[model samples]
Target chain A: MKKTELLFLKEDVDIPYNWAAGRYGSLFLTRLRDEGKFIGNRCPSCGKVYLPPRVVCGPCFTPPEEIVELGDTGTLVSYSVVNYPFIDPETGSRRPIPYTLGYIRLDGCDTYLSHFVDETDPAKLTPGLRVKAVFRPREERTGRLQDVLHFKIVD
Target chain B: MATKVAVVGIGMTENKSRWDLSLPGLYRLAYQRALEDCGLKSEDIDAVAFGHSPEYFEGVNHPEKWCGEAVGALNKPLFRVHTGGTVGGSVAIAAYYLVASGKFEVVLAISGNKLNETSSAQIGLSTVYDPIMGRQFAAGAPSAVAVQASKYYSQYGYNEDHGLMVAVKNRNNALKNPYAQLRIPDYTLEGARNTPMLCHPLRLADMCPTSDAACAMIFAAEHRVEAITDNPAWVLSAVAVNEGINYVDRDWSKPIGLRKAAELAYERAGIKDPRRELDVVEVYDAFSVQELIWYEGLKLCDWGEGGRLMESGATRMEGDIPVNPSGGTLCANSIGASAMFRKAEAALQVMGRAGEHQIPGVRRALGHGWGGGIQFHTIMIFGKDKP
Candidate 1:
């Protein structure tokens, strides 16, 4: 096989996007920002509390009614300690290496919340371990899930 | 009764991170091979169904416009399916629907992905999630699947060795497949275990490579297939099932979407026992652990026995029901062509044209694809004889 010369070019392109929080999402975030509380909507048919408050129940196909308050503590369902460093898409910067990611089933909610774990060591994390959400100070609250910095091991 | 459809031709390109071929060149290479395999002209194809993942992977928007002429579907009814990673199987399903509806006699399904073209494939995939809820947290496919692997590991009594066993077997199988991208000719459990971990419990070797390749298959009505080929792989059934996008309602380990899809397909194909009745299988295994999860999801084994199923060596090429003899998605995953590769490989197995990977006397086979946060699942059944 003959060696082939290759030419390459690199260019940057920008694609802008604007998204609507929707009625349910906006309500959930507003409550978290103002009152520093987590709110979920209860399905009318199945009565499953959907965290982040989706408008309708996917299985039942019925709209949820009444946003209810949820607890900050939960059980760890699954977790991973990422060992590689990669550029974060949201910030376009390198995220801290060896971070612990987890799925937590918050109390009073049926679904698992995908989030980061405060502990970076894999040995400390275990399935069914009780954890509590640590929120940012009230003045610095952004209303996003990030306001609840990460889940930490709780007694 | 509905019209029946069968696969009369299949073609594929070498799975690689091709820096030489243009996007259109890849499509043309696979498309021409399919036409030659069935002894038909491009003009014979009445319509085309193109499958692809996100356009950002190749930095191209509306790719059909740039590549339609290469596939010889310039002015025909060219439909595009973009169901995330499951697009490949959905494209095949779309082609089957076109012919089975009796509206089209011949249809062509084509798909491929060139991950090398992207600046960062992992970051590109992260954009698929909600910008507000998930985009910031999602690290890519490996981390996402890691959580699922953790859940499965916690629910079951399996360990990392089970995942390593899967990696060793799939890569060994790829050695027999000429078109496969990753072929560790001298693969072993030790090498797989020693590979660097990408995420906890998931190593570099456990994940699929980002490949650049094209796959094309020709689908025809039963009546039309009679004149085209004597050994047609009849498409007995096809089904796609989708669950809610929310991760809350999902049990990633169980993959209810895939079970639902398999149930519908097996019911339609009259398959009472998948392990007993089906001769071969090609389920999605982008991650090594996923193959085991699929065994349970597809009902090949009882729940929580996926790891034991691997340890039993029942899924090997020479086992009772050979799975992924063509090496599966884990060996050569062109995101867009990955699912269709399963379908094409299954057809080849039933048609006795798989060459080295051919399972002897394959009477019935199943091809499956799962994508979109373990939510979208597609399954198709193929048989040697018409249903």
Candidate 2:
């Protein structure tokens, strides 16, 4: 038997992190850091409201007919505490792990929006937990999903 | 009697880490080749059926919109179908329906994947599993296949040598394929055995290459087939079958979707014994173990006999039933395009157009694709003479 040297090389490559922009199904989430205003898209065909509006209604296959104002209060449908740091597109760096990401079913919307949760305790999180949207400060507000700081446990 | 649909022309772009061309540029190259092969212009195409895997693979959503003009689908009836890796073959199946219905005289089926455009296709594929059940266990495609391989070996008492032999044979065959991406000059079973393991029971060489390429095929009704080419590869049967996504319920060691899809295709193609009736086979082998599993799923061999089939050299190019004469997805996998390439390669073999990898006297060829956690499966049967 002969021995062969086997080595794996990791290449550093510059890649486009924002290639999803300008696409037809591009999702737009308004930064709601300071205010509690809720936004959603309404499908004219089915009259169903979709939170974190989709370009086309999954059932109807039609573009959203109108924009609807949703309630900031919603029920937490599902959640997970990410134990590993994930690459952040905005920073091009790894974000701290153990952060709470949850699906919030806003009032009047048929679907849920995936966002960060403020409460870090995994034990405290449960399905159907009432939460309210917390917005970023007005000065730091940007027109992105991150503008909605996180979802906080509503007292 | 329903009119038969046959493949009139086929074309494919070079498979590699394509950085020289953009997404649309890739489609134009294959589309042009297909049109020229059929001796027709874009205007002659009645409709377009396109398939690409996850939109995330290209970092573009609604890729059909971007690829419309390049594939000559601009302002034409264009439909996009995605079933993960099987999407390419599914697209051809969709095109066949259009021609078989006697509504469309000619349909152009195109598929492509730009793995280079995505920062990490592995990450994209990893996200496809259930967020909770499989995501944590996901070590990407290699690890999943390795898990299946481990189970198969444990159950069947097969050794790692079988996989090494497959890698060596496929890579060797790739030398004859001009479109193959990973061409090794002195590839051998010994070289494969020494390669580092990406996951247990699965070495790096056992996995398919992440190439960026496009493949297109023109489908026409029986009335229009003779006008396009004298040697049309008639489509005998096409079938797509889906199974539950949960890997826990099904046997990962064996693919049920593939078996079901193959059974349905065999029934429609009037095939009694695939080993005797089918002359060539192009299966979806993203991993070496998958080809072995597919050998049984396709019924080329009995259950628990896939390893023996390989050991007996029954699947070689000169074997009783030639499998993967095109080097399969192992040599070049442009995910979306690979499935279409299987169908195209099988058709080419039947048409006697496959220059180097052609199996002598190939009359009936089977093409298959599987994707989405192995939940989606597509099978197509092509023959030199009309069914």
Candidate 3:
């Protein structure tokens, strides 16, 4: 046993994920963050509203005729408490757990939009609870959901 | 009036990694087998109903258009069906309707999935939920199933052991299935229990493997059945139902779509007791816990008695009512092909062509598929003799 010697072996490989930066719908979120505005598409056929705007209206199968400006105030339709921690891409580490995720019905928009919530208590996050978007500093805006920071209790 | 319909032929490729075949190649394999099985060619097929999940998984848009020619749907009546994970079963029901409506003499129903084409199917599935509410919190399908399993445990005092039994039993059943992609020689309860957890309560072994496979079934109207095969699996009933995608009011623990779809299917099939009337069942069991949950939803057993059904060997190969004789999605899962496999397996059992895993004396069988956050459901009933 004393005479035995050990050796270590290692290998290196390049793992690449070639994702297009400005392809498809990536530009849509960038504009929203830069402009500090809420834009949604209006269906001409059925007059239904689409938030974050889709190219075609699902019910009518027609393209959106016009863009409408939506307000930050909305109601929380439903929510869940995420107890599991997730890794943050920017920091390359896990974030705090027990964050609230909810579906918010934006003002003047027919369809509800999903977003993150600041409140952690499950009881406080219920359907029809009024809330407002809390945007990050204008200098820090990057045309993403993080630009809005997170939704906080309006009342 | 709805015309009567029957499954004249059914064929499925041997489930495997299938590294050599493309999506179109996989479809042709099953399509050719089904045509030969029915003693007919592509010209005999009046219409075709294609089933596949999202295009993102295959990294292509409108996959039916890509594989339409191979399925022999070129310039013919072709309809694409999508219902998340349950697309396969939904395609069968769609084909049944074409024959039942008296609009087509025979319809070719086909579905397949090539998960091997993608690096991570779980990453693709994460985008299926409501982008705002569930998207950010998405843990993929396994985690979502784990949430439901956790809720089931909290509501009923079921431990992790119940899920372990289901994993062991289904893996064991796959040994007899020649087409099964994953076949474990000797799987024990303790081994299943010790497998590493992906999401809480759901271990690595508790989930289905992603495979490239295809399943096809030929449905014919009453008059055309005799021309195809004498041992036709008569379609007693077929039903597709959907619930609200964002129904914030409903309970997530027990899916409402399953209940509504089961009720309508049982009504049309004139089934008073599914456990006694149905000889075999092919349920959507992408996750091990789902099979147990479906046992109660399908009324094979009362609510909360699904664990007992597995433990008592009621759903075993030789049990009172064998479930998933084809090893189910657990053994071979091509998401889009899974639901179709369920329908094809049920049809095969009724036709007495299930090979080693065949349930003896199976007369009537039940097939089910559900998908999209449990919002979509499809159910079909098949019998050996005419209804």
Best by DockQ: 1
Across B254-332, the per-residue lDDT of candidate 1 in tens digits comes to 8877888888999999999999999999988999999999999999998899999999999999999788998899999
**What DockQ does each prediction reach against the true complex?**
0.67, 0.03, 0.08
Q: Pick the candidate with the highest lDDT.
A: 1
**Per-residue C-alpha lDDT of model 2 across residues B90-150, encoded as one tens digit per residue:** 9999999999998899999999989877666776776675442234334446545655676
Weakest lDDT window of 10 consecutive positions for candidate 2 chain B: B130-139
lDDT of 3 by residue, B279-336 (tens): 9999988888888888988889887888888889999888998889788888888888
lDDT per model, in order?
0.88, 0.79, 0.79
Candidate 1: which docking quality band?
A: medium
- Candidate 2 lDDT, tens digit per residue, A46-135? 888766565677557788758787878887765554443344433445566556666567878877665777875655755568999887
Which parts of model 3 are misplaced by more than 4 Å? A1-155
The residue pairs that clash in candidate 3, if any, are A114-B132, B88-B340, B89-B339
TM-score comparison, 1 vs 2, better candidate: 1
Q: Is the docking of candidate 3 incorrect, acceptable, medium or high quality?
A: incorrect
TM-scores, chain B, all models:
0.98, 0.98, 0.98
Clashing pairs in 2: A33-A135, A33-A136
Per-residue lDDT over A43-133 for candidate 1, one digit per residue giving the tens place of the 0 to 100 score: 8888899887887887787888878899889888888888877778877788887887888888998877778888877767778899998
